[model samples]
Target: MSELFPVQASEASRPLASRLAPKALTDFSGQEQLLGPGKLLRRLVEADRVASAVFFGPPGTGKTALARFIAAKSGAEIVELNAVTAGVADLKKALEAARYRLGQSGTKTLLLVDEIHHFNRTQQDVLLPAVERGDVILIGMTTENPSFYVNAALLSRSTAFEFLPLPEAALERILDRALGDAGAGLGGAQAALDPEARAHLVRMSGGDARRLLNALELAVLTTPVEMDGRRHITLAVAEESIQKRSLRYDKSSDDHYDHISAFIKSMRGSDPDAALYWMAKMLAAGEDPRFVARRVLICAAEDVGNADFRALLIANAAFQAVESLGMPEARIPLAQAVTYVAAAPKSNAAYLAVDAALREAEQGPPREVPLHLRDANLDAKSRGHGQGYKYAHDFPGHFVFQEYMPQPVRFYLPDGQGDEARIAKRLAVLEALKSEPKAGRKGEP
Candidate 1:
């Protein structure tokens, strides 16, 4: 057999990442920003260039794959080592081999080390000469912060590319691909995914493609199949496959969107119990705390508003707490925050105000600020800039007569809802004071 004609390896021997490993950048699902045209890695490969590089990200984010991919393309010799397995002596051995091979063959060297964060400072310093002299391109991968874990001497030489966890949509696509993949586990199983189960697989996997596929592989295998025309996997089967009993859960897939919808609607409907229930469901489902906090913050400002001003504060504080503490302990603060927001007085008055303002602003030239409100500090500024702008503090009760809104611009008509009803009354008195300033004894200078 000619050395030029390569044989594709059998399916079972391949790790899912290998079997599913995208042959080209085109086959790769995630890292669109990195793989899209004019991207960093793509540019280096296209130029037949070797840059000392480090890929920093969470596990299974294609870091090692990227290292190997670059190595294969560059016609370089790869020296592999896991930090856990390789000591200073083993590292020196690999360095010797890579350097010797490079010198003999006129080849560039790629040292693909996984969890390079595990390398001690002294161990890492050994490779500095090779990296600096361009004898080897050190392609290091780490799940931890490189700035903290890596030797500053070595860090200075490499370009660090931070990889991100795939989004839910990309994860969804990955799940489908894994199940639909013939060479992988799901092919002969007659598996038809339940909407909820599919979502569960994605949500539980938590944006790790390897995790996602492994769980989906496990889930489908656990499923009991039935023959309708062919063996079709069912919701019950998926439930059994996932958690053994089944959940009406899955964030991006089924229960994720559903619970969020339920939570929002529960708040809008002023059903605290339902809202809290949905909130708990989201947390238990491993929904990101920041995501949950973001929604509550929106609900506080948009759905509760002045009806319960403290809701926004609570929601914001909860977000901060979650960020500081992360999981487990953070859940308590999040739960307290959600309960507070849900129990608060309901009012869409603020959301309505913005919605109305945007609608009117988009409608016509009236969107422009009144001349009185325009910037007046610069050259050739008009006289009307602060002319009728009454000094409210100069009068009693810090109130004064003024037409701040020029004409009849009513962005927030108050809606006469909840506390807004009282706010509307106060606004009426202000308008009246402007109309008949003399009668407003409270506004007299």
Candidate 2:
């Protein structure tokens, strides 16, 4: 029930990211849209008027830091709970303590819930009354889309702010600050970062300030001081410190949908390079090869359509290859399918045609099949089902004019691209033949 704060570690022992966390808004590196001068969020925090709100975004974007800063500025008792670790009982205790403090000492508690999206509907619902009645100012932080994961009632009562990845310039500024700040930063280390090393850290951080600082700290702390009395962090040292760039991707979150959407759109837009890049990023981030293959297959059918009939074949082959041979080797077939689909002539005509026909079938009045086109074997002689049927194979060019449907409807207009161009020409000739009068009908007119 006691007010919870981030575990207090000694300054010397705490991680650089924790030690160098911004103590003031001025020290915060990024999120200009939210923390910039005269912004609504900044004004709210400055005025100590921040109530129930949700901060959602990728990590190292200053959500938690801002929450702590808000609590400090408003002089409110801050209670921190990680949804990953906290249960219903823990939540109840925090809320009860907040209510008691508010009533007894005229104090307000700022409840910071990290990864709030991990909480189920029941857990989220528990915070609604406290939030609605203003018993505690709830600050829910999540990386997932709040609208999807957070309860509707809880979300509606909260102001949601999306934090973006820190820009390169902001990240650079943070690196500079961390290096120069004598009190909380590594100014005492007297470490001189090589130009290439500095750029490598910034570029590989992927707009994450904490990642940049952590890598910088590791490079400096582990390297031996040179004769010049400075620990020199070269490009090699920086690479060793942050070996692999952690791509921002979660299989069940925004990154998964966004990356796939980008990949599909790139292929549809005929940008093979962009399509390949997104595909690689998804795969590198542990996306299933089969999932990527499935998307490629859909794109071929829906976007490539009949323009390049071969595209669908290639996509299907790629899907089969992915299933047979997984990972590293599967990437080749995926690349082949992605590039082929992206470069192929695109036409959604076939896709559109089926959808338009579906709407008519589902919504329009019912109509029976034309008598001539009905099953002839059942009642060819008695019912006159096939009496007037004109067999196209019996005529020249395998062509004949006949009513195939009770009510004719136009669908499947082919866009002139790839093989569809030849199909369009063939259809045009058929239309011309249909316009001409039959051999014996000219005298009657």
Candidate 3:
């Protein structure tokens, strides 16, 4: 792959990232876990025994770089394809070319698919047969989680290596290399960046080396030459060049779902601080505030329940407020609801009770309505719709014991918390009255 590109004498003609990319494992920085002494990947590449594998990680984590390094050392003809633009036809052509090359002179081909997660299931399946047959050694590079995006069968057949984001110290080392190398860096141009500017660049890059280098190049190329005939990158220049860092968030990706799950669990776990932190992250990433509000409402019912009835009201109010007022402002009510729900006494008794009843109903046919409990207004006298119904208002304490169901049934078991405690006591008294042995009365206790 290195020979595929013409060697350019002038470093300024090429992108800083391309010029400074590590050509070997020794040159590559970060990922000590994978590339350290005696690591599996390093041993495989060094021994020229590279197999079909997937390198998955965030951007600027060296997925493609590592793949190229392995191919260079493997002594195999590497064929690169961008999954974003390439279709099944392109994959078929590449596979056939690999087979032809292999048959002609016993040469091997390593297929490097960049952004392999972008390929649909069918496109990924096309590589499965060839990869299994060893027709082409497949190396897939993906920023997304391979488990969700790649075919299960394909994933099972290949080894998956995780490339983590470069740490700050590693990024700093890369910056120094790019600045000091004469042939492939800004050394010949005598470009210097201020300490403050360098710090800003490193921090804003969010552990992405490519982003840091691109911003540095833009700052150097655009800044006017100083009196000493050297380009100086200032803090202001760095800020202007990289106005905003690319957030590590994809709305339709795994991170988005994971964040939301964390937020909901935080609230349910009664951790207000954790809940607020996740909410802030989502809001900063431009998530829908209404979605947060809805989750709060659910948490109130499912977690707080009768233990703090006020929680549900507050959550509902917050939901309405969020609907009326869009974000920035809506974050207030959402935060308020989250805190209230977190502080409220927690109980899942009601949630559990409803689910239990629902399961019973689903397991069998619907229960029939008792004749005494049917609508009395609809021909009550002729059909005896309200037969055997006892009027509770006429009795002492405005309560009467009567069978309301054809068969006995009990679903709700209230937890003794807040107002539910009093309800539980009252239910005990009523149950006692209903169970007291009758003296002489018929159909009465």
Which whole-number lDDT from 0 to 100 does residue 351 have in model 3? 95
Tell me, what's the RMSD of every candidate? 12.7, 2.7, 4.1
- Winning candidate number (TM-score): 2
TM-score, cand. 2 vs. native: 0.96
Question: For candidate 3, what is the total of clashing residue pairs?
Answer: 0
Q: Give all candidates' CA lDDT scores.
A: 0.73, 0.89, 0.86
Can you list the residue pairs that collide in candidate 2? Answer: none
- Best lDDT among the predictions, by candidate number: 2
For candidate 1, the per-residue lDDT at 394 reads 65
- Arrange candidates by lDDT, descending: 2, 3, 1
**Model 3 worst lDDT run, 10 consecutive residues:** 436-445
Query: Residues 1-445, candidate 2, lDDT per residue (tens digit)?
Result: 2355447568989888888888877898788899999999999987889988999998888998898778777777889899998898889899999999999998898899999999988888888899888889999999888998998899999999999999889999998988998888999889899999999999999988889889999999999988999999999999999899998899988779999999999999999999999999999999999999999999999999989999999999999999999989999999999999999998999999999999989997799877788789989888888789888766666667777766878788988988889888877776666678762223211
- Per-residue CA lDDT of model 3 for 58-84, tens digit only, reads 998788888887877777888888898
| Predicted candidate 1 versus true structure: per-residue lDDT over 108-133, tens digit per residue | 77788888988888888898888988
| Model 1, residue pairs in steric clash | 199-253, 250-256, 251-256
lDDT of model 1 at position 206:
55
Model 2, position 332, has a per-residue lDDT of: 99
